[model samples]
Target: MHIGLISETFWPDINGVSMTLAQWSQGLLDAGDQLDLITPHAHADTVGLEGIPWQDAKPFRHISASRVPLPGYRGVKLGLMLPKAAKRLWRKSPPDVLYIATEGLLGLDALRYGRQNGIPVVGGFHTNFQYYLHHYHLQWLTPLMRAYLRRFHNACTRTLTPTQAKKNQLLRQKYHRIHRVGRGVDLSQFYPRTTQERSLWRQQHGISDDTLLLGYTGRLAAEKNLSQWIESYQILKSQHPSPVKALIVGDGPWRDHVLSALPDALWLGELTGEALAIAYSAMDIFSFPSMTETYGNVVPEALASGTPVIAFDCAAAHELLQPGKNGDCIGVNEAEDYTARLIHLAHDYQQSPQRWRTASAKSIHHLGWPTVNASFRRHLVQAIHEVKRHGRQRSDFVATKS
Candidate 1:
């Protein structure tokens, strides 16, 4: 079956959405399906957006990134050239069904064009744009964002999500045709590794054998609540005064802000492949206080790395925690409580790492990407069959009625 994927971003970009797109595209290609991906090609500059060449890896790739123009507050806009982009791919060979990801202009354009052409449309529920508006201090933009997401998703046959938690939340807000597409990780790259990794990381960071290392991995932005981590880190050092080093992996707009605020913390910059593996292995404990994540991909990856994590019991924590054995969860009732628990864990690092190793391995071993990919392939096929069986026009495609 030929499938079309329209996302706002794709690979070589280090974010959760792009990673997931790469995973799903590869998965579909592996399942003996061809994919036509439509997205804003970041590298090119066309009137609206441009296209970049991408090669497929089998049952697994979604190639050829197409771009479009998008406007924003920064004197520039980034987006996909929807109708033109889709037409370009369609001319080669259109897919049996179209899947839209991201709540961006590019995705909406693709969905609109697909419907006009009688192509069955489906969607993936990724970032909650409305929720983000509030976090960005754009309270006035919430209603507009909400309406845009609602109208955009309403046009699809189904909107797939990584967790039932997100699906239920979207449904409560009246999101139509929501479906669950469980997310999994690559166990091979993120599983328990004992010796060489830890030693090398400690050496690189200039830490002695007795030092306790606490780390955070993922984007460092205002939404992540990194300020609290700094405050909490200060409190921990002052109260207990242990030889603890803080390691930050990954970079974002907040890099300067973080460096200015916490001058002593080791900045590993952006890490990938084995470097990412080494960064995770080097850390003794993982702590995150980010409020903006839909599902903190790092939590599962940390657990898979046999590194214990302490996170507020919301979203990702709500989904991944088995409690005490593998990880420690902070109460969602308040933010201070989250900070307090991280303090407690920092005071005693030995027990947390030992217990976390066993639990982390348990959590990641069975969640290989193959499982999630296979399920998605079946879902795409099923949506295609549903359209055919019902003979619904693209514009007439109704989200699965609750």
Candidate 2:
């Protein structure tokens, strides 16, 4: 089946959504499904990627707001994608399925085109635009963001979410055709028992053996609730005479601010491939404060790499984190409690290494990309069947009237 995937983010810009889409596209291509991806051509004239298979890529009209940097992620842009751009490029090659990923302008445009043209439209929740408002002190806009999100996802034939809690939340909002599309992990890339790797990674970053390495990955911007992290770290420092070391992977607009906030932390800018893998393996504990993620991709990645995670009770924590099994999920917005957990973990760093490694390894198996793709394909096929059943039902009613 041919499927057209549209989003506001793509490669050359590596975030969770972009990477997840790329992996799913590869898995679909392997499954012999043709994919035509509609995304912002942020970098014009960009060509084939390295080590990745050949794929079709297209660009759309970039809005003035399109180029604006996400407050937390310096590398990614937050803009409305013009659906007309999808229309111009995809009208001829429209797929049996039109999968929309983001809720920005481009997504709306794609939804409009899909509805008008009678193509099956499916949406997947990738980011949390509402929780972001709280980080930036725009908490009052919660209703607007929720309404916008509900309207967008409701338009799809089905809305795919990674967690059960989110599914319930969306259902309450009256979102249509909501379904749980489980995510998978690349187990080969991340595993435990890398002592030398941990050593090398630590030495490379000047993290001594006695120093507790608390790693946090993702954008360094405001939406990630990074101030909470810093405050937590300070709390750790105030109690413990020895300062715990922090390793921040990934880059964003907040990089400069992060430096100003905590100049002493080890910053590896944006890392990928084996480098990212080793970074994950070396951390004693994983702490992520960002509520803007529908699913925090790095949480699983960290787990697979054998590091235990610490996140608030939301998003990926609700789906992937199995409380004491894989990682710890702090109470909602309980930054002090979040900090205390990390501090407690840091004190017992030596004891946690093996337990966390085992937990991480166990959680990784559930998220195989091939498995996720198969289930998703089934959902699409089922949705199409439902549409057909409804169409035939309508036809029979008209025949009876005649």
Candidate 3:
């Protein structure tokens, strides 16, 4: 099968959607399927991201769209390809299915072209753009944005979200044919380090082995609710009996702001491959305070590395966090509750480190990439079959008229 993936984000962009697409595309390629990636041209500065096998001179085709820097977030770009441009690229060798992974203009053009040409199109709900409006001082646009998103996804053959909670939420908002498609972490790539290795890593970072190292991975954006993350860490550092330090991974438009607030934190900007694994393994606990996520991939990645997480009860946290076992999930937008839970978890870790470590490592062992990719492939295939069935019905009606 041939698949065309349309997204504003792709490999080399340090975000969940980019990473997830890279993994899924690799799975499709391994299963003997052809792919064409449609995304914004990678900027000259977008280097040192996790390398993908197919990013350069790989089997799949690459198509670049016209792009502009997103307002207020110069580090990210939005893409758009005109309808004629899309047609010219796919006139002879169009894909069997089209996956629209972002709701930007690029994806909008792809959806229009796919529908006009009778190609199957599937949508992915990866980010909460509406919730982000509040952070950007555009809360007045929330209802309009929500309506536009509903219309956009509803036009697709099916809309796939990363968690059941999101699917239920979209369904409540009158979305059609919503499906839950979860993500997976690479067990081999994100497992826990040995005791000695963890100790050595902490030593290298100027941290004592016994000190509690709290970490936060992913973009340091306003939507991530990072102010609260900083507040929680400050509270812990001041009051906790054990020494507490923070490790900040990844970078974004909010980099300067985060650095200003956390001058003492160890800032490891945008690591991938083995280095990222070590960052996760080196931490004693992980905090992901973002309530505005379709699914927080960092939560699982941290869990896979034996780092228990404290997050809001939404997205991937709602599905993966086992409260007392793996980590704790606070109520959505409950700032005080989030800080309390993080402190409580830290105390629990001090009491019984082995229990937390074992459970965190074992909790997500079932979420292998192969299983997740296979299920996603099946969904895409089903969309193609549905299009074919509809085509056959239309042909039969014409034949009866003749």
TM-score of each: 0.88, 0.86, 0.93
The TM-score of predicted model 3 comes to: 0.93
| Per-residue lDDT of model 3, residues 1-402, tens digit only | 999888888877778888898888888887889887778865332232335634332456676678898887766888866335556667888889999999987887787777767788899999899999999899999999998899888778888999888899899999989998889998989898888999999888899977999999999789998999999999988888989998999888789999999889999999887899999989989999998888988999999999999988988999999999999988885767877788889999989987898899999999988889998999999999998887621211112210
Candidate 2 off by > 4 Å: 42-75, 78-91, 241-243, 322-325, 392-402
Q: RMSD per prediction, one decimal?
A: 4.6, 5.4, 4.6
Off by over 4 Å in 1: 42-77, 83-85, 393-402
**Best candidate, TM-score:** 3
Backbone clashes in each candidate structure, one number apiece? 19, 8, 0
Give the per-residue Cα lDDT of candidate 3 at 179: 97
Between the candidate structures 2 and 3, which one is better when assessed by TM-score?
A: 3
Write down the lDDT that model 2 would get.
0.72
Q: Number of clashes in model 3?
A: 0
Q: In candidate 3, where is summed lDDT lowest over 10 consecutive residues?
A: 393-402
lDDT of 1 at 114: 64
Q: Please write out the lDDT profile of model 1 over residues 1-402, one tens digit for every residue.
A: 888777766766666777777787777766667666665554432221122112344322334445433433221234644645457657677778888877676676667666766678888877756666665689898888877778778778777888788889889989877888877777767877776667766876688656667788887766778888878776766666657778898786678888888788898887766778767767777888776667777888888888878888767777887656666777766787765677677655564456667776687677777888888888888888877787765444333221
Q: What does the lDDT read for residue 91 in candidate 2?
A: 62
Candidate 1: residue 10 lDDT (0-100): 72
